[model samples]
Target: MKRINLSDKVITALKSDIASGKLKKGTKIPSEPELMERYEVGRSTIREAIKTLAMSGILKVQQGSGTFVASKIKSETLAQRLRRADFEEINAVRSLLEIEIVRLACLNRTDKDISAMQDHLIQRKKAIETDQQQKCTDADIAFHVSIAKASKNKVLVDLYQNFTSVIRDFFTKRKEENMTYFARSHKWHEELALAIINRNQESAVQLIKTLLNNNY
Candidate 1:
């Protein structure tokens, strides 16, 4: 089996052990070598599983000490949960996030940030012109991700990155005929970028709202 699938199995096994009280919270887990022996996988696969669980708040790793069970119940990360969320739910949160991001970006964006946003928009336009749905979707997300980074808020940038992954998945699953949305919204994205470059907070926020209203 592939290493990714192997790591997933290890993660599931570890979670099951924790849920079953076999690996109690606050208890140190088996060493890397021990885990490798048990799962019959390489050290890298076991380490990847541990890392993923650690990020999700299931396991905790201490440098030079050991890995330990942090939670008895599985705590799903935002990225994991977002995959299961519907478009309406994701969009509602995204709308709120984008509005705030654009507002802050307008105030905080630097020449570098503006240049990155402009580059993504250029790629987005090219993707649309080529009728490459997946590339268009990627470029669209990149454009907004640049905006989020310009917010000068680390938390917002992380949340938007995770949330946009879900949006990217949603876009990929869409039929070819449904991809007009990306093309239609390209102009609005250009306008939003310009608004941010001009540091027009009100106009940036309103343009984001318009994009959201039009289901872009």
Candidate 2:
């Protein structure tokens, strides 16, 4: 079994405490040292966990004042909210994201970005040939994420990264028989990389539309 990271464990413990009302909203949390001892983790682990909670709006950090529970209910991040969306809804949003990503990528992409896409495509092909479902899913996502990065839009890249987690889950739940889709879509993916490399903005955009519409 994989060991959970220490900071993640602390985060879960803290959230549980909040949910049970042991750490009520508006109450200041223990000092860093106290938290370290309570969780039996190092100071860095405690700090990392607290920082994550703060980012999620579960905890409020006031410099020199200490941290407090901002809400008994954890504020949902966009990625968390996305987990509830159906595949169709997520794909609709994906279409919007990728269209703009490809457009920007065509304009901004560097040779390094093109290399990343090509490498992922190779991994994708190898995964399909070896019938490695997980690798195929990873490479497919990576290929698109490379495009998002190539676009030079940090916000778009972050959004796509979150959206891909839900997509990864979708890939895992699929029946083995559905592996055929990966095989069939490989050529389209190859073409997409080529279009991006060639800086053919229109071709890249059209390919993305077709890829998304085909439900691949």
Candidate with the greatest TM-score versus the true structure: 2
Q: Please report, in order, the local distance difference test score of every candidate based on alpha carbons.
A: 0.89, 0.89
Badly placed stretches (over 4 Å) of model 2 are: 1-71
| lDDT score, candidate 1, position 38 | 96
lDDT of model 2 at residue 129? Answer: 95
TM for candidate 2 is: 0.67
lDDT of 1 by residue, 1-216 (tens): 699999999998999899778999999999999999999999999999999999999999999999999988755688988998887988899999999999999999999999999999988888888887777788888889999999999999999999887877777677565468887887889999999999999999999999889866
Worst 10 residues of 2 by lDDT: 1-10
Total colliding residue pairs, candidate 1: 0
- RMSD to truth, every model: 11.5, 12.4
TM per candidate comes to: 0.66, 0.67
Q: Using alpha carbons, what is the TM-score of model 1?
A: 0.66
